[model samples]
Target: MAKSSRKANSGAFSRRKLLQGASAGIAASLLTPSGSSWSQSAQSERGSASAQRLAAITPESLPKAWSREEIQRRWRAVRQKMKEAELDCLLVCQHHPGEMISERQDGDADIEYLTGISLPYKWVVLPIEGKVTAISTNQVKGAREEKLSQDRGIDVRIVDGPWSASIIDAMREASVAQGRIGVTDLADASRQAEGEVTYTTYDRVLKAFPQAKFQPASYLIDGVAALHSPEEIGVLEKTTQVGELGLQAMFEAARPGVVQRVVWLAMFNAMVNASGERPFSVSVRADGPGNSALNRPLEEVIRAGQVLSQECSGCVLGYGSQVNHSVVVGSPVPADWDAAAKDSLDTFEEMLAAIAPGKMVKEICAAYDRRLVARGEKPGALVIHSGGLGTLPRGGSAGAVGQIVLQAGMVFDVKPAFRLKTGGTAQFGDSVVVTENGARRLGRREMKVVKLS
Candidate 1:
């Protein structure tokens, strides 16, 4: 969910302040990877003032249980795509941070997904016939240890100066500086449609390798990345559990007159304590049924009868899972709310029925629209989007990337929403994975709106 800003009183500390202070401790505990994977060199590097500052600028590499087999599987899949595309190499890069991790300016998913390094300012040059190389703005000593622990090998280097200059060096070292190279960015046609590579980087690459031909090949990565491996599926399943825990905590904390930030704090603690990573996928808003969706949590007090609609997510490693809930503050639950909940669930089931291997994504949207049409109700945007490494393959609708075929390993955060007759929105979402037979929901809770009394 996109974040919205609101003004708040920056005054004396309260329980909210205490809770906020404790969040750093919770984050440290949650991010401390299970074993001793950090190399002594990495620790020494971080010990320096300059190195520590550089580390602060880069995204932290979370503990991922991906095996050498999984890494090899990805390499093979990407190589095959290169062969099909007749490209000599791939310049897989992420130049900007996502909206979710804007505070940290975190790295994009493609860099982390392909190579295990998760630095915000990094680039990877993968050749069809040579070695894979990574260029980082800061040293990632733990990255080497983590990859070695998994028995995976990769060449990692630091960029002393210009990003494009370092990238050009990496390209030359891989022997693809002047080859027919394919360039990819953080963009995906399904959601973030704009390319992330800066004009400066592109221009320098072109200038350095005038003979080289470069083409947009984001599809090569996106196509292969759309499907998850068995290991990936397991990680996603656990992430969903973490998301559920956060949602439950948020719901339990919401009551009449409670500040929205208080509710957000409860959710933040629950997720971080569950070994999840930021940016925690969460959105909270307390409004009447007729109001527009609020993408961020406000400091307003919760009132009786206002609906608290929120989306909670848990991210483990780099995979994230989300679940949404709409709670009525003090209820005689409105009939409109009741009807919307039932409608969302019914439409979700319909979408699930259409989520089979070889089925186009449009079929899911069609199912959603059809169900609402039959209900004679106004339909909201189909809230189903691909759930995988960093915001790739956002929701596909009948009009957007709907032709993409469904596969067994593809995951989706499906939540069918509808507008209430009185004015607000009602929806329920759960992370689900497509199976050989059909689709299975990852959440353990019952699908319904909570009526707080």
Candidate 2:
């Protein structure tokens, strides 16, 4: 189990600006007639801003595109899931960043994983049989849509109004206006409870398609998305390599007299230079002798005997892996601190041993708890959530969902968090994938407490 209190960094690609684009689209809807498209003037304003920003990076310069085979595999999996759910189509919303808890930095992982595009306020209409159309609010002269079509080889439709109206238009075009439609925002385990769609948007959708029966179908995608393909696993390995570099940079920069913020920036620069995109949360806990809380870098200088408890991850192509490590600045190491730290690593190893294919979710959690007890330590919350595209299943244990049989190709972020009687804390874990034999670590860092003299 890996537990964390993650913070969000909107990324260098201003997610707030993307939200503003969504707002602009919504505001444009008010200016237009109830059943009509956006006004010409309103479109020009929105398009210009997006176009200018997109001009900096050419399609050739973009990160390696997903293979056609991988796309087909994902489509087949999702369609099979849809078939099981007895749905005519899926209205998968791809909107503003940080909208979902698990997807705070990376925008909608479902769309990004499926279409390989990271644009905001877009809605994808995937029919049971036919072309998949992605409706975008910021398309000028079909240039943006055309670019997407050329890149992802999917149909791109330019919507001139809010996502609610746009989705209705797309559904009608796909001939699923009155069919069984599955909306993504309904309920995603842990990430979303009542769904991510606002009341206004859902109400508008309900009013437009009164005949269509809508159901919460986020699980349909969530289940399929959790199992990564071979291509995705390769990408995850590369992403973990980049995250390791960031961790190394953090360790090098952390020393007596250096501000915690400077150390964090050092890690950020190293990861970005290594082709990293979204940088997830990094907590630098150097409070005192018994540090248990995670926090952002402050102006306080690092003291000689202070213990630094840190957790961080670096994102690449919308994929990231986490690493939690701790260090003592100048050690005459405390025996109790060293013992607790080693026990955390031991607990993590035991948990990993129990994470093979066909294992039950409760079994893994039970193994984790038993190991802590064997060490004469009180068991604490452990997090063993899926790590893929970001918005996958999340929970204190295997998942918020009930007993699930572990399968090969499932990736998990397993961390065993330990809070000792001395008020000190230690969390040891890494990103791992379930294989036929056992779990494999994606982290390159050594799992142990470091003592710096």
Candidate 3:
């Protein structure tokens, strides 16, 4: 039987409230059966078979894994880039030493890659010639560092002092006095230097050793961002699989008079029950008019003729992958919707085909513009969104929305969207990797609007 919509407490729905409500809806859906006869038959069979079940399994158990060698190889590449940049040492800090924000920073993968440790409020120093030391605020235990160092065959050091002092001391110990040291402080490092009297912590480090020159580490970071190791690929692939499965579950859970939160919960449950790692974001939308793009699922009940657009991400082994799809309930796909989705997919595929090593990013953007114009769509600001998907350090750069020059080993999510003449929009996206010859789709499924009526 179709489940009735859950009543809402009186208030405007914020994103958090929507998520909370959706979680409840999802729980309810799992407990209720669909009205379909096949569903009822399956329920009956499941009830009969329950007595023959085996031992229960816990999904929280992570698989025994080995990626130390892979991480080491990536670090070697990063070290090489540091050498090319003429850096004496590279410092990767998680949060500002004294002022820690509750929110996490986005680029911890780089630090995690260099050191086989995953924690915030830490600093990783990769000297051009010497050992790599991971300095932190004594929050990490000595035994953990020893195990990580032993597993990766690298030195991991724990410093017991203020963050700035530890950083300075590590540099001094590494003999980084007279050469250029690369710092990832894209902000506040300069002012932290007390004028010429005493340079900021970064400046102080340079002053403490007059021969050391301080330089921005963006280029070196970019270099590491461009490459991916095989182990990283494995993590990314697993994440993609998780995303696909979660999406399927969300689609199966959607129905008329069902709440949008129910579909979102179904997706989340799939990820959690599959033992997928943390850092997943799932969003679901129903067919509506104005401000629908920004509309998260609310207490409003889903109708039979609505379209559900779902975007989901799964992060496993510290790598992330995303998948998006639209599902229709009890209605044929609209002609305009079909055309818009097909054209978007076609444009995305064309962009993927154009990716190759050594192609200019600007040229790729221009091609995308030309193609969109030919298809009767206006190409606005084009940005390249391509990079490595790995637990190790990865970077993404903007290219044309329609086209981006490809580089071998670069993985990307090509999602091209267009504003439809009607009251809605269309979008399709897929993950692909650039190879020596061309691009390869990570997931084999064709880009199309899926109807589940």
- Model 3: per-residue lDDT, tens digit, 258-288? 7766666666765644433442446667663
Quote the positional error of residue 62 for candidate 1 in Å: 11
The collision pairs in model 1 are 289-423, 289-424, 290-423, 290-424
Q: What are the per-residue Cα lDDT tens digits for candidate 1 across 393-444? A: 6554645467677889888788777766545567777889999999998776
Give each model a TM-score. 0.80, 0.78, 0.72
* lDDT (Cα, tens digit) per residue for candidate 2, span 112-209: 76676555536778888787877666532344324644455677766666778777776787788688988886675335566666778788988988
Best by lDDT: 1
TM-score of candidate 3 versus the correct structure, residues matched by position: 0.72
Give the distance in Å from residue 338's predicted Cα in candidate 3 to where it truly belongs: 1.6
Q: What's the count of clashing pairs in each model shown?
A: 4, 4, 13
- CA-only RMSD, every prediction: 12.4, 14.2, 10.4
Q: 85 in model 3: Cα distance from truth in Å?
A: 1.7
Top-scoring candidate (TM-score): 1
Decoy 2 TM-score against native: 0.78
* Alpha-carbon lDDT of model 2: 0.61
RMSD of 3: 10.4
What does the lDDT read for residue 77 in candidate 3?
82
Full ranking by TM-score: 1, 2, 3
